[model samples]
Target chain A: MTVGILFDMTKCIGCGACADACKEQNKLPGPVEEVTTAYTWTTVEAREGQYVRHLCMHCLVPTCASVCPVAALHKTPEGPVVYDADKCMGCRYCMMACPFDVPKYQWDRAIPIIGKCIMCTSRVKQGEATACATACPAEATVFGSRADMLKEAKERIRKEPDKYIDHVYGLKEAGGTGVLMISGVPFEKMGLKAKLTDEPPAMRTWQVLSNIPDFVAVWGVFLYGVHWITARRDTVAHHEAARKGPDTIDTTHTGRPS
Target chain B: MNSTATLPAGRFRLGFWTTVFALLTIPFLAITFLRFSKGLGAVTNLSDKFPWGLWIGFDLLCGVGLAAGAFTLTAVVHLFNLKRFEPIVRPTILTGFLGYIFVILALMFDLGQPWRIWHTIIYWNPHSVMFEVGWCVMLYTTVLSLEFAPVVLERFGFHAPVRMIHRLITPLVIAGVILSTLHQSSLGTLYLIVPSKLHPLWYSQLLPLFFYISAIGAGIGMVILESYMSKRAFGRHLEMDLLEPLARAMVVALGIYGLMRIQVIVRNGSYADVLNLTYEGKMFLLEFVLGVLLPVGLLAFRKLRTSPTWLVVGAFSAVLGFVVNRLNVSVTGMERASGIRYVPSVMEVIVSVTLIGIGMAAFALAVRYLKIFPEEKPAEEPEPEGS
Candidate 1:
């Protein structure tokens, strides 16, 4: 039921039509180019004479969404990870957390906010494809259910293993991104980020954070016990010295041995 | 050498350092004005490639790390009931309190909206590490104020409230230690999301542990260094008996941190990172050698531990190393993956310096007005004639 985009880099023609259509649809106010920016949410970068498109991977377990303190960014059931500006505190943690480095901030605004591809959730709800996919001339960008996208991608790779890289980018990266890609060249060579763990980054942080309650409980009990014993020893030694009074032996030392 | 002679003179000195603070702060304030009026791009050299810069690395990361002394010292004196270390509890709390104030100011300046910081309080995402950090920092700042309220009360001759606060200190110390441990370690958790971005040398599952241990050492080191400066500034006698034991504790903390760091590098097979001697590797060497190894080596010597001068040197080196360690994690370790070399603009450094000035100025003012360093009560001493 998860909607997604399947971008075939081999079919991309390096044209800037998708970029222009996105700007027109989103009403982004800035200079028009396929450059990476808060206004320009997508980039059709070139590598060795082939065109490769880059945008938000939109993970099933989104680290940007998980790390956001206000839950300003969240994954919708329809499959587009979206941002709510009304809830955003502008911490820029989402910028730091994105594995693909996709979230861009409007640094020049009076009040800044994160800007990234939303997978055109409004259009998809109305059964329309994303602007970039609709405007794509070469059939490079296809929109469908994630299951259909994965099935079609694997079939294409199987039919012509020599024609494609035989691996689908974003299939399991950061725990399987919603946007899938099949490229002729290796993903790393195409300036696509590589080596991300299949496990989501949020899971790593939680491994440490989940243990915190246990740590606090154990440490708290141990310290309290020590404080109690020290106070008791101090009380008893004070009375012992008082009974012996001023002219007693030189037991100058007292209280828990420093 | 009484307080009357030395205190005000040291504070109001119209000297080179004061002129420097003024010189830097004027431009610093001007840049700040530009930042708010225009935008972040107006004053900062930051780009999408480098979302964080000097503010996050130096002001936020290093500033918070340096302020660890307040909780560590408080726990030692109150929770552990080591009465010998009691003299340092107040000043360390003041330093920590002022340090957090500066961090908040810096964070506001760095935030794009700056006003919506309160959104974190109302909107709860308990899953976020930043959420934990946010709550802990706010709560701990309050704890610090309560811990230090007695000093302010004592200064104002409010004996009733002072007595009430004294009775409540046990719970206050417990809360402070817990909250500080939470945030101090969670600061490290902020970077755990960027495993692919952060270099392997700095990235580990044990980052939170490393952060907590190093911070404890940093806390002890700060107490040693600040206490030494306060001695000269206020003409107070050096409490060597207390400070020596404090230094010994720092040695153990630093030793543990250093061992763990070495183990992480060795187990990850990052030895080639050091052997290759690239820019990142060299920076790692500097942080590991000077920041961890050198300080631990110096303090481990029994002779060096006892000497005030040597202990100061060792602690200062450790503190310097700690600053580098944080910068290495937040900035240097991030350089390779970022594909852009980030050198902060002049205005960035100036704003940072201005914040430091404000922190120091506020600390000095507090020291002047409050009974932060109280003279010992004469009742405890046996009569001189009897002795």
Candidate 2:
């Protein structure tokens, strides 16, 4: 039921229509930018003699969403990773954590917030294709249910093995992003992070964070146990000193009187 | 120096260093105003490619790490029942409290929306490492305040509150240690999300453990340095007997940290990267040599550990190493992947320096007014001549 986009680089004609439609749909200002910025949500770049679109990958388990201390960025059930500016304290942790370097900051504004593509969640929710997908004259970018889009991408590669690369870039990178890409050129040559682990990065941090309760429990008991044993030892030593003659001083104990 | 010592106790004096700090504060204030009015882009060299810079690297990471002495000493004195260490406890706690305060102050500038900092308390994101760090820091600062409260309360003759706090002292110390452990390690966990982005030289699954162990070494080093400085400034007797044992502890910490660093590099099969002699490789070597090998090798010998001069040198080297290591993780390790050569702006450096000056000034004021030292002797002797 989750919506998604599959961008076929081979079909992209370097027309820049998707970029224009994105700017217009988002109400962004001015001519289309050559690269993604806080104001520009998406950009089409020339790489390896082909057009490659750059924007938020909107991962299945978004590192940006997980790293956000204020829950400003989160994955919607419908498929997109959305951002809430009101909840954001502008820590910029999202910008730091995003694997794709997707999140951009309004760094010039006095009251800045994070800016990134939200996967056109409003249009996707209305059962319509994203602005870029709708405007793709060559059918380079297509929107559909995630399951269907993934299957279609697989089918395309299987049907024309020699024409397409044998890989889907987002199918496993950063634990599988919602925006999948099938390219005729090798992903690495096209400037993609081709060697990222299949596992989500958030899980690495979670592996440590999940142990907090156990650590607190054991560490607390151990500290208290040490305190108790030492306190008893001090008391016993004090009593032994008392039993000894006044002339025999206990130089071993330097602790203050409890 | 002798004339200032002749002045009445509990009176603040404007010394040469104090005047220098005041002069430094002027630029910091102006830059701070410009920062807020024009935004972070105007004052810092940060970009979309490099979101963090010197502020997070030095001001927050190194500041918090150096302050780890407070928890370590408290646990040693209170939990382990080693009362010989009780003398330095109050000052360490004061340093920690002030260090955290300045960290929060630095954060106020780094954050694009400083006013909503409290949103961490309101908003819930248990999955976030930053959330855990935020909660632990907030709670630990409160714990530190309560631990140090007795010193202030007793000064003002607030006997009842002091006694009540004394009753709760053990629990407070325990809480402080627990909170410090969580956040100190969690700071490393913040980098876990950047496994690929951070260079292989610094990145490891054992980052949290590495951070924790190194913090212990730096904490002990800070204690040594603080004692030496206190002796020079106030003509206080050097606790050579106590510092000798702490030096030994520093040796053990550094040894463990060094061993772990090697183990990680070997396990990752990245020893070749260490010998690659690239920028990151050289920085890593520098960090290891300065932070670990030199300090450990210097302090491991009984003859050197017992010597005050050598002990101070080893401690300073270790502290410097810690700063370098943190910067390596925050800036150097990330440079190539970010594709931007990030050098902090002048205003950024000034802000960081001013924060340190403020911390030092605050410590001086506390030493003057508060009963930081157990043996209350007036500053009758002349200050020491050399560093």
Candidate 3:
């Protein structure tokens, strides 16, 4: 039930077919010469020595899902982080929270919706392959259950040790992502960061804010008590002073007792 | 009863809404049109990278921060029971109420879907700091209104409810102060989520503490500014007898804020960022100098505290400094991850201009109609008995 994609960059021929098919299937505008909304969900970024396809990794514990205040972006039980435009208030809290910056805004629109890949969940439910997996002329991309794809990725690296790099990207990055990658070049050289910690970015802030309610409640009671005691003392002192005439009364012993 | 108490019984003042204020509203109206019709993108230079802009930076952040004057004064006068400062209580509360009204107005503009603002209640995300800030702000606004209601009722010649409300004002004022304190600190806590994104100098775990302390300093600065302006505009005497003691408190407040800020800097080992030759570094120095150092130095002097001109100058500087700090957090400090820089277009500036224009005009109207200033005492009256 847990399906995923394995994009092996060592075998890709840098063809624009997969990207083209994605645009058509998703009803996006046709591809431009450079990557943009009209064409670019699957972008081919030029690394130092290789070209890497960039798209949402569809993380297991999606940072995008955790940060969306209105729950516009979410993780489905099947595993892809999907965007629900109807619920989107477009506050863009997810943008700041995402380390990879996958979700893009349609800035040109009068009323824009956040845009991100949904892992072709519709095709998966229909028991068909994704457009990119189906259209790959070189068999560069493979689609199957995450466990199966992961096993195949490790087996390929093991059989031909020198042909592929000794690393599997996205297997455990950001608390393990759904999409796995086997690249000939190092991930850092492929313009993909391998430095992100397993901890979701929003937790640090939540931890601090969670402590406030308790503090505020305690502080509120303390301040109210102080206000009461002070006011009552003033009232008593005022009554005491009123009993004495102004001519002989001393002002020093006024509010509160001497 | 004086002629003033009977309500000015003549034609409305013709020049009441100044030409400048009217002119400012034109852009505001137009910007509002584009905002609703074309959406937030049309009216603001806001990107996903910068979700908040000038309205939040100026009106809600600095405005509410400055409005801290009300609670600070109320706490000093009512809690500490400093009888000499009683004349300022009503005016301070009025300013706080108006400032809060402006805050709600600003929020309305900044919201991407203003219609769904009510969803904060229906879909309450208890873990979200924003949920806390939203509820706190709404509750505090209510507290301020109730704390200020007696003043309005007193003017309308309603004595019974006024007396009943008077009994609750003391507790209401305390509740209002506590709520304000929570939200004001939480405002800074909102930014703590983006530690890596915020500039090192501005980003710290101590953000909440710094925000709370700076608000108090800004609030005192606002009081000084208000007292000075009233003296010039209404020909009222500057209340230095009260302000002299207040200036001493401000000195201590600013001193604590300054030390705490430096302590944070040192603890983060980002103290070197202050001396770093980067744009963020320069801005940090400017925030430190104008917001904390210069104001503290001026207020510390007894002679400066007594002089209306120096006090006003110090206060204005502090206010400007607080505004800069907010802008730095919201706009200037966010490093460009998208490789795009944000510059507010004319429409964005127009909407911001309108909000400020309306706030000023509304403030002027309140001053004219609400009996905001305390009535001047008789020339040769005997000294009133003290409590």
Candidate 4:
């Protein structure tokens, strides 16, 4: 079963309990910052009088996993995209590719790896909710199977149309994220991108990359054909000069024809 | 007669340019030390908002694009069997080889976990554009090395190996061209994932095609500029006849690039953006005019194509334009979406300049010790009075 998180902005009270639990569970040091950084994985932003928690969307087909040269970042079966520090070369293509701008780098460290929320895959795999979800006192953040979460989000919006925006935030963004959100206010006002294509961004890169085999096959044959034709013509020209006379052959070697 | 008699003498002396290069290395070394010990934060303006900056844009993109002459010239001389253009082959290959080496060096500094660079080799990610580019670059550098091995072998009188390499030369050149075509275009494909993030004027589904075509133009322009500079430095003869055809080729490549660029812009329905004269629009116009229109106009005329001064001027303009285009795509195009302004730090600039200085020094040394240039037919010996 693919576990996921559903965050409801209307229910959140900006208590910062989830943020504290995240730091405690991850053993992250220092006080919680206003913004997400290498040390802070999640934050609650106060925007437009609504409390919005900012963290990794954990895309179904994560762009971070796709752009990595070394396959350091990958999606776990539990619905979280995880990172392997040992395999990471720190090219930062993932940071550049993530539409949500979730990934942060440890720029101050000589040897660094990317930092992002992994949706608490360890707890989810053991049939437990995420640290943030468990610590959420108001029940704003809930963890369940992706199907159940998406169903609840739709049900909530349908039952109280006036209380919601009539849409689920992550249902279609970046080809459907594992983390779902329903907000009374518009997503754009909460710092979420409203214009992201429903299709996965990785598919665009795949469109070009998939053509490599055909290109190699056709281009290889074409180059070889040109070489054969040129070599044959040069040979024929050489033989013709030889048949003409010794004088012509001498001049051909001494001077190139313009 | 001594073989050295035909060589250009006294040109490889330790002089003013060498001293300047040496002086520039001091700051680069200092910054490099700071970068490793104190970290990238101490030496660069890079942040999560601007993950990539001048190193990726100028060093990797511009360096690889300018080195395109190696594949282009190899195909022309070896595959096409254009024997008349053989004189410049060795030097062009040398420049291309050095270009790639320096690009890798620059990458080592840019990567945060550079020690794990070998993970790309062991790990496979066929879906990644970076994976494809990395493999192609590695294989192409090998192909280039083999293509150039014969020259080194000949100098040492290793006839067996030279003959073996000569037999393998045709296939080597073909492989080099294919590899180059893949990576040069793949570099542009890296930006394809950011359709929304990149500015509309620079973003297109056909980014790969644009990058490949512009690289061809820049490659030819680099060859022309290299020829002129070598003529000045080594006191060698300028092969105007060969360069004239190449100048025409540059015009055609840039012309096609310019037309396709306008077509893509129009088809994307962004023509209004072009007329609006916004910041992005202004940068796009500068890239188009400097890289395409100006160079194509200058080199289109026969008189200008034949004149060394005008030819070099046009070539320099084309090269400069190519640099601006890459920078626009990498930095300026993403700035609005990123909500951050990225300017290279002083240390970053020094590192780039130092890498270029190292390349030039390597090329000069290669020319001095190796048979880079064709022998100047020992200036027609004065006839004996009796004869």
The per-model DockQ list reads: 0.65, 0.77, 0.39, 0.66
Sorted by DockQ (best first), the order is 2, 4, 1, 3
- The positional error of residue B12 in candidate 4, measured at the CA in angstroms, is 5.8
Superposed on the true interface residues, model 4 gives a C-alpha RMSD in angstroms of 2.1
Candidate 3 chain A weakest lDDT stretch, 10 residues: A248-257
Candidate 1 local lDDT, A5-52, one digit each (tens) = 999988899886778887888888886655678998787888866888
lDDT of 1 at B296: 86
Q: Where is model 4 more than 4 Å wrong at Cα?
A: A248-258, B1-17, B378-387
Docking quality band of candidate 3, CAPRI definitions: acceptable
Per-residue error for B13 in candidate 4, Å, reads 5.1
Model 4 agreement with the true structure over B58-77: per-residue lDDT tens digits: 99999889989999999988
Runs with alpha carbons beyond 4 Å of true place in candidate 1: A247-258, B4-11, B376-387
Q: What's the TM-score of each model vs. the native?
A: 0.95, 0.96, 0.87, 0.95
Tell me the deviation in Å of residue B273 in model 4: 3.2
lDDT of 2 by residue, B1-387 (tens): 232322246556688887887898899999988899889998999999999999999998998999999999999999998888888888889888998998998999999999999999999999999999889879998998899898889889999999998898888889988999998899899999998899888899989989998999998999999888887777676677889998899899989999999998888876786787888889998999989999999999999998888899999999999999999999999998888899999999989988888888778777777788766344644323342
Question: What level of docking quality does candidate 2 show?
Answer: medium
Query: How much native contact recovery, as a fraction, does model 1 achieve?
Result: 0.61
Model 4's CAPRI class? medium
Which has the higher TM-score value, candidate number 1 or candidate number 3?
1
Clashing pairs in 1: none
